[model samples]
Target: MTRLSAAFALALALALAACGGQPASEQGHADEHAAAGDHAEEAGGHSEEERHADGGGEHTDEQPSTTIPADVAERAGIEVQPVGPGTIADEHEVQGLLTPIEGRVAQVTARFPGPIHALRANVGDTVRAGQPLATIESNLSLSNYTVSSPIDGVVTARNASLGGLADEGAPLFEIADLSRLWVDLHIFGADAQHIRAGVPVTVTRMSDGKTVETVLERVLPGMATASQSTVARATIDNADGLWRPGSAVKARITVEQQPVELMVPLSALQTMNGEEVVFVRVGEAYQAQPVEVGQRDGQRVEILSGLNEGDQVVVEESYLIKADIEKEGASHEH
Candidate 1:
């Protein structure tokens, strides 16, 4: 009885111990799965936080940058210059006509009215003073009439012909001194005061395209009765016979004087806000400077202020530069 009872009791105890260890192994496996899930969630949240803090680094590096367009700069065509001093002359241009300086117009007349016998001088013929122009045979008995030139010049007009009646005070020929000529200038009433004797003058003839330089010789005391304007005379040397009488011309008279001022070419100046301005080059850029102007000749202009001597200036194509600067300023405003 003792041996069989011991064997049965040992087997029952072993079976009960095996059944108790099964629940503990399943609980340890469930705890391991929950811990793995928590660790995975924490790691995913930390990765997302880092990405947000970095602000999408690769995309931020790819943002676009601003730059000046080459086409705009090309169209602008900007130019720059500096300030300087130069000579400037103020002159006035007036219209005029040419005339003989020293000459005599004579009319041929016969003591006894008769017909022309022969002709010596014709129109446009050069003759010396006192040279015979024409001869006439009178109807009166034993009479001969001879017409002569009164000055050394070209014969501008002639009316004597063969067998033509010779009458008193009849114009046979007109002679003019071709060596020297005069220009009759008409000045307005207000400008009359500016013109005087001995003022320098330059005359340009329209027909032959010649320019003659001279000085004002005389000014008529009274104004012209027809035009109510004063008349000024300028004498010119014409030894080359380039000038002719009765030719229309243009005369420039220097009037005002402005001594020793900073000057620049007329092309160097530009108008800005109703004031004259110039672009001064400065270190790969340009600065606009306002300037005051005084007297001006044909090509140069007097600078009254806002400039110094020995400053480099742009003479050619300055207007184009001004336009570019204005366009750039407008673009900045927009």
Candidate 2:
């Protein structure tokens, strides 16, 4: 009976041990599942944070849009104006130099062979007509010293010096009346037809920025052998002595005038595809319009076609607009 009791007790201990092991195994599995769920929640939260940081927009592989700087635009002093139908005058361009009017230059000479005693006038000296430029002691029968000047002008050349001998008709001095000057221009063969005597001309000195208004004095009878261009003379008044003889000058001669045509400032036109175009203001942007151009004045251009009167155009900073259009075009091409 005691042995039976011992076996029964051992069985009871075994049953309690089995029950404890099962509970411990079940708890470990539950803990592992809870950790896995927490990991999944953390991963989902990270993905959402990334999307918010990116502004909820897909990143594109494209160049960012650019614009002109405000400060640069302001500094450019851009201006705008309208195209108006008006008279247009064509001009011909020529290169020329300054010279005295006809018969105004004089060659001072001794009436008879003599020796120069003294020279009162030097090159570049202003002298009046009959002013004594030099004193000459005669070698002829007269044997007397004489003083003389033949014209009113600036002495441009002097051949007589003190104690120098002079021959009859020898040049003692060269005097030129600089009050009036001439520009001898070479007009191209094709352009020569429009040029005529008495045409109004505008002369400009590129060095000094001085401009003179004059008229075509004459056109030489022949063309230059080397350049095959005709010579056209333009005469200008130089009372202020600003137009120096032999100074280089540019001449613009008005050739023909059209009663009416569409006109715009020259600065408003830009070259595109070997054709002239103007940027017309449209809302906040500018659209380039191809134009047919005719004659151009100093700061204005004649628009023959492709534009109407009263079209608002950009007179300045038009190149900036052109650049923007080109850039956009290139981007599209890419």
- Candidate number achieving the greatest lDDT relative to the actual structure: 2
Question: How does candidate 1 fare on TM-score?
Answer: 0.64
What candidate 2 gets wrong by more than 4 Å, as runs, is: 1-72, 140-144, 206-209, 224-228, 271-276, 282-301, 304-308, 328-334
C-alpha RMSD values across all candidates? 32.2, 26.6
The CA lDDT at 192 in model 1 is 89
* Candidate 2 residue-wise lDDT, 140-209, digit = tens: 6756666677777888898888888889889888899898887888888578876789878889997887
Give the worst 10-residue stretch by lDDT in candidate 2: 57-66
Q: Give the distance in Å from residue 235's predicted Cα in candidate 2 to where it truly belongs.
A: 1.0
Scored by CA lDDT, what does every candidate get? 0.66, 0.72
Quick one: best TM-score, which candidate? 2
Q: How big is the RMSD of model 1?
A: 32.2
The TM-score values for the models, in the order shown, are: 0.64, 0.67
**Candidate 1 residue lDDT tens string, 1-334:** 3433533443333233334432464446547756865686687733433544665432221111111122322233433345565556567788888887653454444556678888998888889877888887777764776777766778877877788887756677777667777788989867888677887888988877688788888998988788787889988888888787888999888765555557787888878778887655433334456678887888778887766665555465455445555654465477
